[model samples]
Target: MTASTANDQRFREFKMPDVGEGLTEAEILKWYVQPGDTVTDGQVVCEVETAKAAVELPIPYDGVVHELNFGEGVTVDVGTVIISVDTDPGAGPVAPAAAPAAEAPAAPAAPEEDEEPQGRQAVLVGYGAAPSSTKRRPRRQQPGVPAQPAALQAELNGHAAPAAAPAPAAPVAAPAPAPASVASAPAAGRPLAKPPVRKLAKDLGIDLATVAPTGPEGIITREDVYAAAAPAPAPAVAVPAAVAPAPVPAVVSADRERRVPVKGVRKATAQAMVASAFTAPHVTEFITVDVTRTMKLVQELKQDPDMAGLRVNPLLLVAKAFLIAIRRHPDVNAAWDEANQEIVYKDYINLGIAAATPRGLIVPNIKDAGTKTLPQLATELAELVSTAREGKTSPAAMSGGTVTITNVGVFGVDTGTPILVCRRVLLRHPW
Candidate 1:
C-alpha cells in the first residue's frame, strides 16, 4: 500500500453529536451535508426544524455522514444519535460530549405569546432542552398569583409563559419589502425603529394607528411607536364586550371513513400534513381568544373608504395581531440555532397562511409582513389563496414561512394545532 493509503485510520467516522442546547429532538429541515460531502467542524452543515423555526445546524466534528437514521423531514429526539462522520478518528481529537458553551446564548427573545402554535418549546437539542426525565415535574404554585392560562406556556417547555397583550395582525405578500423598510425611520418608506420602539409605545399608551408614519412607504415601525408614545398617554377606555366565544365542540367525529374528496388541494394538503404530523413530535395547547377589538376593528375598516373592496376576515386580524404582538415579543420569530447549539431569534416576520386549494392544503408565507397595514394584508391573503387554488404558487412562496394559521374555521372547525410541515415554521412571531 502507498504510504498515504497505509494510514487507514484517516477514514474513521462519527455519529451526529447532540447539539446539546437542551434539544431533545430535531426535524431535518434540509441537509447541508451528505455521505459524499466533506465538511469541517463548526461549519453550517444543515438546517434543522424545531417547534418554532428552521435553524441552520453546524457539524460539530470534521467528517462526512456515513449514515443517517432518518431522511429529511424526520424528527430525531436528542441523544438518539444520527449521521456517522467518516473522517480520521484521530482527527485532532473530536470533542464529542462537550456541552454547548454558556456564552453562546444568554437566551434569545421569545415569540409573541400567541405565535406558539403547537406547544413544545424544547423538542430538538439546541432549541429548548427537554426535561431531564419523563416523570412529570411537581406543580409548584404560589399563592395570590393567578394560575397562568395553559396557552401562556410552551407545550415543549412544559412551563407557563408570560402574559402578553393582544395585537391585531395579518399576512404579508411578496419577497421581503424593499431594504428601506428594514432599517431606520423615514418620512416615506423605512423599516421604522425596531420592535423595542413599539413596546415603548404600548407601555406609554400611544396609538400606532394615529401616528403619522415616518417610516419607509409611510409605514409605522416600532421606533415610531416609541417616538409617538414617549410621554405616557392616557389609556383608551376598552369597549364593553358585545360578544362571547361559542362553546368548544367535541373533536370526535361521528362518521369514520367519510368520503372526503381526494381531489385538488386536498391531496397536496394530505401529503404535506401527513409528512409533518407523523414525523414531528407534536405538543399543542389551545386558547379561546377574545378578540373583541379585532371584531370592532373589522367593523371600522369596513366603513373606511381606503380599505374598500378588501377581504377582511378574523384571520386577517389574527395575522395583524401576530405582527403587533411580535413588535413587543419577537421571540416567536425565531428558530433553533443548532450550529451554535442554541435558539436564534429573528427580527422579521414571514407570515404564513394555510390555504385549502383545489390542489391540496398549502401554506405560503407573506415575507416581510411585520410592516404592512390591514388593507395590504387582506389583499395578500386574497392573492395567496387564489395562487394556491390555481397551483401557480412557486416553491419559494411555499418556503421560508414563519408562523402559520390553519384557519380550520373555513372547514367548520375551530383552531387546531397543526402538524409540523417538513418540520415547522420560523421567527420570533410565534403565535
Candidate 2:
C-alpha cells in the first residue's frame, strides 16, 4: 500500500502485472516510452513476454514518464515497479531526493489514514494492477557522509573531477609516477563501475582490472572499457635486414563464435518442451492418409461464395476433420489433473493451431472450435495465425487448449512428431 514518495502525491508507480494467470515473471521485450514522454491513460508503454505469449502492457493513468526501472530483455518479477509517472507535470520537476527516497527503507512512514486505497486498478492484462508491497532493504550509511543522489553520482562518473577537488601537492620529482599510479590503480580493491558498465566491459572482452578508470571515486565508465578493447596501433619501425621478424603466433579470435543469451518466448518454449518430453509419455503414431480428395475439396471451397474472403486450404479441412473426430471420440479431449489424481474431460474443445513464428513456436487456439461454422473457423484461424506470426498473440489465446494441429508442410517438412502442448493430443500434417 506504500507509494514511491508519500510527499509527492503526483508521482505514481506502475508495477509489472501477472499478465498470465499464476505467471511469476516476464521479460521486457520493448519500451515504447522514455523518461519525460507524456502519456495518456490506457496508453501502451511497453511489451513483455511471459511463458505463454507476448503481451503489451498499457499504463493505467495519464502522466509524464518519470523513469523506467529496467531495460529491455531484463526479467522482472511480478509486483515489481517497472515505471514511474508524474501525474502533474505542470507542477514542475520534483527534487532529486524523491528518486532515492523511494529506495530508502528508513524514510519516515506516512500515517495509515493518509495512504491511498490499495484496491486493484483496471489494466489491459491480468486480473488488475495490484499495489506493489515489495520494498527495498535499507542501505547502510556512513556516520558523517550524506547519501548521494543518483543523478549527481551519474554526473560525477560521466565527467572529469571538479576543479574544487584538486589533488594534494606532491614532490615535483614524483609527479610522473603519481599520474601513472592514479590512472592504473584508481582503487585499492576490486574495480568500481556500474552494473551496466561492467556488463559492457564483459561483452567487449575487456578486463575491468586492467582498464583505467576515469570516473570519480575510481569508477570505470563505458568509454574506458571501449578504449581498452580498441586494438593498439602497429609500430612503424622496420625490422633490420640482418634480423628476421618473429613468427606471429596462431591465436584464435573471439569473433569466430557468437554467444546469445536465451530468454523471453524462446526460453519459455525450450523449458516447456523439455518438461513435456521428459515428464509425459510421448506416443508418435503416423498414418499416411490419401489427402487428394481433401485437397480437391479445399480447391472447391476456395471458389465457394460463402468462403470468398476466408482462407481455404488442406489444413483447414484437416482441422475440421480433426474436430469432427474429436466430437465422435470425446475421451481424446481430456487432461490428467495430477493434483486431483483424475482425468478432466472437456466437452468444449479449444483447438490450438501451432504456428512457427520468429519468436518461436506458439500454439494459440480458437476458443471453441467445436461450435463454429467452417467459415467462422477459417476466419478465426487466419486471424490467429497472423497474430502469432506478428508476435502479438495474447496469453489467454494460447491457454486451455484441448487439442492442437501443426502443419509441418508449410516449412517443407514432410512430417514430424512434435512434443505435445501441455500434454494434449497433437496432430502433425505432412505435405
Best by TM-score: 2
lDDT of 2 by residue, 180-297 (tens): 3344554465898999999999899888899888897678899899899989998889778779777897867775777888877788789989988887888888877887888889
TM-score of 2: 0.63
- lDDT (Cα, tens digit) per residue for candidate 1, span 204-249: 7875556767766556666667666567778998765776556697
Q: lDDT for each of the candidates? A: 0.62, 0.81
**Candidate 2 root-mean-square deviation in Å:** 21.4
Which candidate achieves the best lDDT against the true structure? 2
Q: After best superposition, candidate 1 residue 10: deviation in angstroms? A: 51
Q: Cα deviation of 102 in candidate 2 (Å)?
A: 20
For model 1, the stretches where C-alpha displacement exceeds 4 angstroms are: 1-275, 337-342, 425-431
Give the CA lDDT, 0 to 100, for residue 246 in model 2. Answer: 77
